[model samples]
Target: MSAQPPTPPHMTVDEFLVWASERPGRHELINGEVVSQSAERAAHWKVKLAVHVALLNAVRAGGLNCHVVPDGATVRIDDATAYEPNALVYCGEEAAPSALTVDNPVIIVEVLSPSTGRMDRARKLADYFRLPSLAHYLIVDSNEPLVIHHRRQEGCDILTRIIREGATLLDPPGLEVVVAEIYGAS
Candidate 1:
């Protein structure tokens, strides 16, 4: 058998950004370690795209100032951790053309797959909320018509709602996304 490649040294969020930019596929920095993301199945991709389109339409129809970004933008959770959400929205100004990270996102989205479901529901639910600017965290189910909506409330409390039909109201950024529109795009 051939010898295994040596593991790279632990890296901070800054270092991970530089390293990830140099490489090709998706990667996230979790607790100072680089975690390579697995290839997404077609279903996962469809749902991800659907959510992006839904959020984009909502932003436009509502005439909100927020900018919606599809997958690939990194969100730094801490000094040693950063995540590339499936989609995200940030108000105020548009991000710089060369910026690698989003400093503030009012809404963050993740489309669940078999491999990521647990982390998305548990770890990510907790980690994404750590951002002061985060008003909502949406976890979309790839296999079914469902969305786990986590909305930040007063103080440190976060309220979660499961949306299967109708619309999900995202305040602060102030937009309403029709559930069917999201799933229909897939």
Candidate 2:
């Protein structure tokens, strides 16, 4: 008897949303498969919270038409993929408090954990840059006082900077926060 061909388990974006909502924890759709995000450590949480607060403060202080959101809100990368960044900044008239997903994010932040470090730095980085509205992608290291900032330049070019002790400036959205502020007593 010939073995039957294995059925594909891939899911579309709509199907992923339905499938993921029934599950208990945070999930992402990558390559048409559901991926559960790792539970963060206390240090990780601290950094994440700090980053959110800093960005929020910046937006408030500058009176910019931008909003900072935590991980619960998803960003649709394509028909087969979506991600919930640790924190994100969305601009323009489309940002609403009631929205569950954001399609245009100006800034995306991720707190690096050992479990997801490689993926965050590699695959996720590539996926996020695909969004035209994305200007900066910050990877904060919880283990050290460091942040890797990837700033999008004109016409497909990108500028990268590593911040250890000084502040990193995020233009287009107009925000500046020191690297130490992100670790914030964690």
Candidate 3:
């Protein structure tokens, strides 16, 4: 196999954003460092598309203020931080003027691939919690058709629920995915 070109050592969020926007691979900024994701394999795309399809349908049907984005947006958290979660629900009013950084989002979903599973399940979950409006952080595993998450509880944050492949609940907009969908055609 040919050697992949070397990526720059690091980049400021703005520089990284500009650079990523100009190119094609999946990339996200964390603490002033630019991290590029591997080109997803077929299985990876399957799970991502499955969940996004569910979310998109529900959000649109509900007529909710939130917007559904596929490969959504890269939000600038601060000069030193920016991230683009795979699928995010940006709820609430988008007033006449809004800032680049969305301090709140009702939900954020990170579908895991072999290369990114660890960070997405831990480091990334922690960051998502920092958003006050983040009520649900869904970690959809490609290997297992499961929606694991830290769901907000009755007045508190808790990892209280596991929406397995067979279950369905209406957080809002009312869409459901059978865990089997995540496992693909196995």
Candidate 4:
């Protein structure tokens, strides 16, 4: 039998970034371990695209100095953890053209898939909020017509709202995103 390659050791965020850059496909560093993201279903992709477009349009309509980035941009959570959200919004000055990581993201969006649903609602929710710059974390359900909005409140208190229709008003950055637009019905 052929010899198998040795398993890589747990890596710090910086090391994982360097290693992941040389590899193919998408990967996330979770608590010092490298976890490869699985293939997504069509429904997941559809919602992801819709969320990206909706956020982009909102930014443009509001004329805010913010950038909406789709998947492939990483957000560092800590020294040993980082996440690559399905979509994200960062305000003020834009990052460098070649930058692979976003240091400050005001809004983060994730389209839930069967494999990642649990983590998205739990682990990711907790981790994303750890960043002081994060104001909103939106979890879009691929199997249902739902969007869970998590907004940061005063002193670590997070306000969670389940939205099935209408719009979500994201203040601070001052932007509004209609639920219908995100589901692509309008």
List model 3 lDDT by residue over 9-77, tens digit each. Answer: 777876776677666677888886778778888777788888777777667666777765556476555
Which runs of model 4 end up more than 4 angstroms from their true locations? 1-7
Count of clashing residue pairs in every prediction? 0, 0, 1, 0
lDDT of 2 by residue, 1-186 (tens): 667443238987777777776566898889898787888899988889989998888888889998889888888999999998899998888566566689889999999999989999999899999999999999989888999999999888889898888788888789887776776643
TM-score against truth, every candidate: 0.95, 0.90, 0.77, 0.95
* Segments in model 1 whose C-alpha atoms lie over 4 Å from true places: 1-7
- Each prediction's Cα lDDT score? 0.92, 0.86, 0.69, 0.92
lDDT of 1 by residue, 5-33 (tens): 54467989988898899877999999998
Candidate 2, residue 75: lDDT: 89
Write candidate 4's Cα lDDT for 19-111 as tens digits: 888777899999898898999889889889989999999999999999999999999999999999999999988899889899999999999
- Candidate 3's C-alpha lDDT? 0.69
Which of candidates 2 and 4 reaches a greater TM-score?
Answer: 4
TM-score of structure candidate 4: 0.95
Worst 10 residues of 4 by lDDT: 1-10
